[model samples]
Target: MIAGISVAVAVLAGCGPLPELDGDPTAGKDGGAKSDSETGRGVNPLDNPDGTGPGLKVISSDKDRAKARDLIDKVATKGRGAKTGYDRDEFGYAWADSVDDVPWGRNGCDTRNDLLKRDGRDIKYRSGSNCVIASMTLYDPYTGKTIDWTKSKASEVQIDHVMPLSYDWQMGASRWSESKRKQIANDPLNLIPVDGSTNGSKSDSGPATWLPPRRDIRCSYAVRFAQVALKYDLPVTSADKAAMLEQCA
Candidate 1:
């Protein structure tokens, strides 16, 4: 028995602090969460395959860009289909965590709160509750701005579907089983918190038609778009793929 000196036990031996990782129900997408530089407000898309990390960081390195290209190249292309009979409700009610079909599901928090906590800085949780976000500073990757957001003006921060549900519908998700559609709708890999106006502008447009206004983040955003597409085996339009590649190029 040792005296007052406390032991510094390691989760793993001879190693530094571990990177936070996410759990996945899907095979092999689970991996370490990568944090960005001093602000620690974002994550690199290349290191966060599971899409559980906060949001995109500027992809400045050529090597990482090439890797992003390789990933993007793997995504198949197809002409987008019709929007007839398309309905948002087909994907599931927004941010319901009623089941364990996807990562962070049924974890005693709704998907919206989970995302806010994941990406927000200086977070203030509601009194006596950790899951309900009362206020936070959000770095909006889409607009190159930081939003001082609070629950009072909730719409100021919008959770965007990287692969929008309507776009997904036109890209063969119209035929997907109901549960699979919900998983894609709420999956962190497909979701991002961005400026409300920017997200609203995006609507259901693909990369060719819309992208983040912040130039440096485009490449990382493309990689995340591809990550979601590949994970769900969803295809982007030929034009969308070209636009995604152009960002990394």
Candidate 2:
């Protein structure tokens, strides 16, 4: 029941150039198989309009940065609302696979696994189940490092909602239907796999308060934040929008 297309497998084949490493544990191993930046990792947000690809690639060109800024400019801005009635449950159970109207909905795999499969390279599935990811090599765009991940050490890698759920709640999702809320929550366009600690630190903060620690990826991250806001007809706090623009500036 996994919906949409199967997770892109090019990552396993090392689709693109390897990212430069500085003390990356997975670096220099197996001739840098683990460091491969392929499989759409580091994809420009402009090229990846739907967000079903791998990691956020750095937007380095002047033209691309201008494009990123243009996208960020289109995102409407307002003050974030109070979190008066927000709750995780308001968007359906975390990672529920049965939610309707999202890319991977009813796909027989939970959101977490779908994302893990989407972003991880050399992915291994549990015995007799393609839906459960046993292990994989993940290039964490947030930190610009590669991770050799296994289910047993699950916290080492965590799925990040590029537009966090609580932030969404404050930014107009509070008035959305249950189904629409669920769609935004599960949408691949809004998710990425990154270091667990980094994800934790982001904790509901928008671009103004937090961003990926890796400076090179900031422009791409800003584009992603704006993309999600535009897709859902949500507005960011003026401060958040300004911070997003600064990343590309």
Error of 2 at 138 (Å): 0.5
Q: Tell how far residue 127 is off in model 2, in angstroms.
A: 1.2
Full-model lDDT, candidate 1: 0.80
Instruction: Report the error of model 1 at residue 176, Å.
Output: 0.8
Candidate 1, residues 1-249: lDDT per residue as tens digits?
Answer: 112212222222113332221121222223443334334348888999887888887788889999999999999999999999899899889898974557799899999998888888899999999799999988776655668899999998999999999999999999999889989988888888877876887778888877776556778889999998999899999999999999899
Encode model 2's per-residue lDDT on 1-249: one tens digit a residue.
Answer: 011212221121112332332233333345663342543255677888887777787788999999989999999988888999999999999999988877888988999999998888899999999799999988777766567889999999998999999999998899999999999889999999887876887889888778776666778899999999999999999988898999899
Q: Please tell me which predicted candidate would have the highest lDDT against the true structure.
A: 2
How displaced is residue 218 in candidate 2, in Å?
A: 0.2
Superposed by TM-score, candidate 1 places the C-alpha of residue 234 at a distance from the truth, in angstroms, of: 0.8
- How far is each candidate from the true structure, as Cα RMSD in Å? 13.1, 8.8
Which 10 consecutive positions of candidate 1 have the poorest summed lDDT?
1-10
